[model samples]
Target: MVGSENEARITAAEFRGGAGTAAWRVTATGPQAVFRAVSLTQAASLVGPAVEAAERLGILADIDVRPEGVIVCVPDRDFGGISAAAIAFSASVSTAAASLGLEPDPARIQSVGIYVAQHSATDARPFFAAALGYEDLGDGDAVDPLRRGPQLAFNPITGDVPRRGRTHFDVSVPADQAEARVAAALAAGGRLADDSHAPAWWSLASPDNHGVDIAAWSDDVGD
Candidate 1:
């Protein structure tokens, strides 16, 4: 069980350092755990325990149970990021899963978002939010209220040479897995666009020149 020390907001690194969080990974959305199961019914069985765990912490758990597994996320919507309460909830869920003979596969934890390059984010934010039925995060980003769709981030166009692609993907994964994922993408015909931000993020382009950033910074301290 979490105590008063676990009530404050913490960085991804701090969250990961705590006990009972080994099964969870800090994603762009928050701390998430992916638990594999043999059947949909088995996956569904975790929902009640997970939800109850979150409720005990006075937070809500976003759980998606599919045919093969269950994805659980504890996001602090009020704090606009991961809070200690969220972490506590995550740990509780993991504990419950363990008791039920389930364990999280951290490598399967990731979040996908859309990156939109714009000259003036203020001018473009409203349009994208309205078009996608997303909520503007007031931080040059927007997200689906139901968390069913990828987040949308508007980045400023820098320098004289404009970016080749106006829109791209931002795949946030565990820091340790960033290099391997990049290599796999390259092996699958993707070309490196930029790696100056390696370890934090890497830009790659598809065969057709579309961009995708494999980002691991989201789980870092300063992200």
Candidate 2:
């Protein structure tokens, strides 16, 4: 539910990751920022409970369920769509843990994924924009028809990345709230790595040091 057909400018695609991994990222102002599913089956498992819990939290403002994953909507600019989605997934995981009669932190990282591309963001943007019917925002940005909401920020890379590149989470988590989110991620088995020295952007490792980034809001966007 990114938005009503009229209110949204959204588009998404499964990008190349590692050898056997792939993920989907979208452009919109909602919780459906990025979804990492190793496969179609896994996507269903991860997204179902997330969607359910998000709805229950009344935080689920929008959604667009896809076979690969889903795009959920949130409320504001300051809200962390990626983090909210993670929490929703955690809630779903917690519910599953309860159903199994086991005591476990649903917030724990059950799986990790890194969205990448076979080509650089420079090349991927035009390709994906055309493939998904989106408009290229340049500088590694692309959006759906409406040109708003969840968005994909392609990180250009040199050398070899796992499976070239795959999709993962990219959102503007505030600098103040970032440490808390990082702490929570660590508590849940995620490792921290600073990909950027800039005060706002950060890189996180999924215990395995995958290349997913949680960025800070910057004024340089689209410049």
Candidate 3:
């Protein structure tokens, strides 16, 4: 088994540089891949290979199989980021998908997280963590131990009142897809809230004023 100390410091660049990682995108949480499957049965077929690969590497992976496709992720809390073993597991899964004629869709891979506006993150962390059944990661962030839910991050409120809703969603996608995603959201009736961070992230509001931030800064792993 790969020790946590050895796997914890691996970076996005390192993972991308490894063989057969074109299908995966490295987010802040870890490396994720989306495989295109036509049905739930087809998606489930990939789970065995994914789990076997992780087992071979003595690592844990989250596999979510849906009717449309399957999402796989490797998140390590010990290192608080991507791990070296993740690269091997991802490569093995990619090989298995290829053998089964399933193609990986990088554009379809994304991570969703929630942001809460708090007057004092320290004071509010415990309540939210308990409510969500999450483990406080101690940096204004809380995560689902099961890796089945979106992560939550606490952002400081600048004024006595929140300018918008107390909570917003942040979707992180591959850097190349951020522009098109932003455009699509706007076309869908969402209004641009902030773009000063364009190419990195963009803040948008739904017709109902719910906020969403399209981010790509963390997924900029280069070849």
**Estimated TM-score for each candidate:** 0.88, 0.40, 0.89
Give the per-residue lDDT of model 1 (tens digit) for 1-223: 3323455667788888877888888877788889988889889989898878777887667899997899998754543456667767777788888877776788888899998887642346788899999998756788899989998888877552443437899999888777889999999999999999887899999999999999984555644
Q: How large is the C-alpha RMSD of every model relative to the true structure?
A: 3.6, 12.8, 2.7
After TM-score superposition, what is the CA distance of residue 104 in candidate 1 from its true location, in Å? 1.5
Q: How close is candidate 1 to the true structure, as a TM-score?
A: 0.88
Candidate 2: count the clashes: 23
Candidate 2 TM-score versus the reference: 0.40
- Candidate order by decreasing lDDT: 3, 1, 2
Deviation of model 3 at 24, angstroms: 1.0
Model 3 reaches what TM-score against the true structure?
0.89
For candidate 2, give the lDDT of residue 197: 55
Each model's lDDT comes to 0.80, 0.44, 0.81
For residue 175, what is the lDDT in candidate 3? 78
**How would you encode candidate 3's per-residue C-alpha lDDT over 64-88 as one tens digit per residue?**
8898899888875654556677888
User: How does residue 169 of candidate 3 score in lDDT?
Assistant: 95
Alpha-carbon runs more than 4 Å astray in model 1: 1-7, 76-80, 158-165, 218-223
Query: For all candidates, what are the clash counts?
Result: 0, 23, 0
Per-residue accuracy of model 2 over 42-130 as CA lDDT, tens digit each: 44554556566666754434443444443333432322223323343434544543453333221211112123354442466666667
